[model samples]
Target chain A: MTMKKRNLLLSIIAVIVLFGVANFVQLEMDAYIRRIVNLCMIYAIIGLSMNITNGFVGQFALGQAGFMAVGAYVVGIFTVPVAMRPGVFYATPMNPAIINIYMPLGVALIVGGLLAALIAFVIGTPVLRLRGDYLAIATLGFSEIIRIVITNASSITNGALGIKNIPPLNDVRIIFLATLITFILITLLINSSYGRAFKAIREDEIAAEAMGIDLFYHKNLAFMISAFFAGIGGGLYGALLGTVDPKNFLFTLTYNFLLIIVLGGMGSITGSMLGAVIVTAGLEYLRVFDEPLELFGMAIPLFRPGFRMVMFSVLLMFCVLFWRKGIMGTEEFTWDKFVNFCKHPLAYFTKKGAHAE
Target chain B: MEFFQAFANMTAASFAQHMANGISLGSLYAMIAIGYTMVYGILLMINFAHGDIVMMACYFAFFGITVFHIPWFMTFIGTIIATALLGVVIERAAYRPLRDAPKNSVLISAIGASFLLENLANYLFSGRPMRFPDIPLLSQNIAVGGGVQIQAICFVIPVITIISLVVLLHIVNHTKTGMAMRAVSKDYEIARVMGINIDNVISITFAIGSAMAAIGAIMWGIRYPGITPMLGVMPGLKCFVAAVVGGIGNIKGAVLGGFILGLGEILIVAFFPQLSGYRDAFAFIVLILILYYKPTGLLGETTTEKV
Candidate 1:
């Protein structure tokens, strides 16, 4: 069989297996473990969206949280039952226009993504003109502006009290399917001619422009698509948590996505997937550092709350300093490479070293 | 007419008080912006950790005074020294290794350094705000006639800011070390070939920048009377906006930008109290507008990109 055919078959089988496992886990596992798995998928979507802009396009935009906030609030507002709207908007009456409109979960998620894309399109017009650090800071500014706006628009966002009783999509299967679709769509885009244009721009904008690639169009396209997925992920997050607040979408939340991309390997979709799982699971595993411990019957004063995040940040610094290229670098998990690695793991290391030297 | 009426309703004393508050806040921003501009000038990269270094300075002084029972003068000296050392160490460890890396990688490293410092501070300080040790002379409220009450530090801050700016200007324009710094900033390769110790100059630049941050922290603590691990985040971002508004890489521009931001923030609240909730958004709006219309910023010279 051809390699493409084999890969196609493998992907199909993988999906089936994932669906089966999700079904079993949903039935067997406790709520906590199931929640973690769902979060891993949600984070995977977020990481992929970030990778599209930061990794593939080579734009250092740091406005993921802002876009996510747009998505979360949009989904939260539309999907919250109409009866609960008054209680959610207790600071003031629910904006009467939106009060009567109730959207299904799927439609709300899409509208959330589209709204985020709309905002990105508006901001990207002026912002994509900037290069390097200027672009980074500009995008960051927009994100902060979004949060501040959300805080003040109490009639809509409920003024920082946040909305509770969001209809929870607690099913693991739903998250798994959503993540799979997002991954496939992004992968296809990255492999298309437009994706090549993005890569060309990333490599050298002037040269790409000389080659007749429209820099503004391609950059904005990638940015909007990224925002769309980020919105979807944000909507899922709101649904998963059963709550949404402006505070939940703070600028610092963007750092989590940054760390994922940096660790998973920029420009590699598989790497982002791997990164999301490891980071999400690793964060949970590191909960021990935040908990007080007793060793030899003596309480450990140093191992207290807040220590986990400290260790996590140090790990991030070490990763940046040492493993700047990240786990997969730019390489994807092709079947051929996987087969070669399985045959001889040492050979992979030696080959990488040779290439470096 | 309504706007005029509202403006007229305010007494002269309240206006003066607002101006004093603006100047005080502006001077603090100016102090921090100097560090940002100098680092950007020399390195051509945002020193993301600069704000955290300021936070660390506050904590250092806090411990020195409260735990060690040291005098305020000694605490100030120690904070400056320690902060300077930290700046030097950060440059050596985090930045030096990535000197030859892509600009984005270096930026990510700088961000990582910032996160590490903030989280470390959070862990060590327990994520709580600490009462800044009161310096009686500086923290006291003084009546400056016409019923205008202002913190004594407000009077002291601008004086210190001006002196620092003058000294910094003289050093950069006149002194040998300053000349070396200017040359390095102009072209590191040419400076190196000219037998200048590039690393040493960079270290000195960081030390000076961090010392300014420490001084800013002291003034910030005096004015605000509270310090927290996250205190530096907002100021850091605003000062960076100031640095950009003043035309990044220009020291004088940073000062001007700082004053504009400080006064702009205060006046916005005074004139449009209803929109006061949008205060934090003001700096960002200014940033976007400036970048769109005049990317070079006020007083900044434009440079052509070379192929």
Candidate 2:
């Protein structure tokens, strides 16, 4: 069979398997396990969105949390049952206009995404002009500003009491499908001319500008797209947690997505997907370290509540220090590469070793 | 008429009190901003961990006084030294390896170092906020001219900030080490080629910056009386903003930026009581405005990127 045809068949089979597993988890798994799966997919979507700016466009914008908050708030406001509005907004009444508004989960998610995109457009106009750390800091400031505004705007955000009873969204199928669509859309975009323009800008802004790439336009485009998906991811996150508060979108929350992108190759789609699974699952697995453990009736002093976070930080440092390129290092998981890797796993390591040397 | 009446009731004494408060706060910010400016002046990296160093220094001071029963003066001295050592150690571990890496990688490493410090502090000290050990001499409220009362440390803070700034200026301008820092900042490769020990200079810069952070932390702890692992994040960010606003890499500019920010914050709240909830957002709004109007910062020199 031709390589193209074989890859298509493989992709079809993979999708079928993904749905089958998602169905199994939805039907058989407990809420706890189902939530984790949903979280992984949501993270993957968020991670991919972040990659559009940070990885592909080479803009070190750290405002994902802000965009996510926008998306989450949008979803929370629109999707909450009209009956629950009074209860949720007990601290201060929600905006009179939005109080009675209710939309289906899918529509709410899209609206959330679009509103996030609009905010991104407004933010990107001024912020994208900054370079390097300045851009990072400015975006971070905007995120904080957004949070502060949300906190102070009591009537709108319910004044940090946070909108609760977001219709529970633990369905694995929907989130998985969202993740898949996001991955595909991003993959297609990244292969297009605009993606090349972004990569060129990333490689050398001066050269890209010289090549007639409208730096501002492309940067804004990449940023808005990233924010749009981040908003959707945030919406899913709100639904999954059944709560949407300003606290959930702290600047520190952006670090989780940062960790995922850095763990997976920064620019690699599949790596982000893999990273989402590993990081989400790994964090859950790492909870054992946080819990008290008595080995042979000798209580270990090291096992404590905060140790897991310390260890996580250590892992982040280790990754940046030793594995700078990450697992994928800008390389996508093509079928050819996978087949090659399967055929000669040892050879791959040796080649990598040689490169290191 | 009500709005006009409220404005009319503001006595000159109260304004003076606010000014005093603003200057003290500005001086604290200036002191911390120096750490950010010096590091940026030398390494061209943000040292995201600088604020965390202040938190660590506060914790060190807390432990030295409370746990070890050391005197406040000695604890401050010891905390400064230990924090300087910690700064140097952080640079060696997290930044040194990434010296030749891309800017983004270095930034990631710096952020990683910051997170590590925060999490480590959390693990060791727990997430509970600790009361900063009260130094009676500094914490006591003193009545100044016209019955305007302020903490004794408020007066001491600006004095210390000015003295340090003068000393730092002397070190940077009139000393050999400062010359080397300038050269390194200008061109890292050329500085190295000219027989400057780049690593040692960078370490010294980190040490001095961290020491300053310790001083600021001590003053901050005394004034605020609360210390937590997350304490550094906001101040660190604000100081960095101050440094940027003053045109990062310019020491005096940092001071100017700090004062402006400090006074601006105080005056805003004094003038607009209803806007106090948006106080944290004020610095950011200033940042965005400054970035838009004068991207090089208030005192920063404008330079075009070379092809």
Instruction: Give the interface RMSD of candidate 2.
Output: 0.9
Candidate 1 lDDT for residue A85: 84
Native contacts recovered, each model:
0.73, 0.81
In terms of DockQ, which candidate is strongest?
A: 2
DockQ of 2: 0.83
Q: Per-residue lDDT for A167-217 in model 2, tens only? A: 888789989899989988999999999999999999999999999999999
lDDT of 1 by residue, B181-281 (tens): 99998888999999999999999999998998999999898898788888898888889989999999899999999999999998878877788899988
Clashes per model (N, Cα, C within 3 A) = 0, 0
RMSD (Å) per prediction: 1.4, 1.5
**Candidate 1 residue-wise lDDT, A302-357, digit = tens:** 89888989888887888888998899887788877776788999999999899999
TM-score of chain B of each: 0.97, 0.96
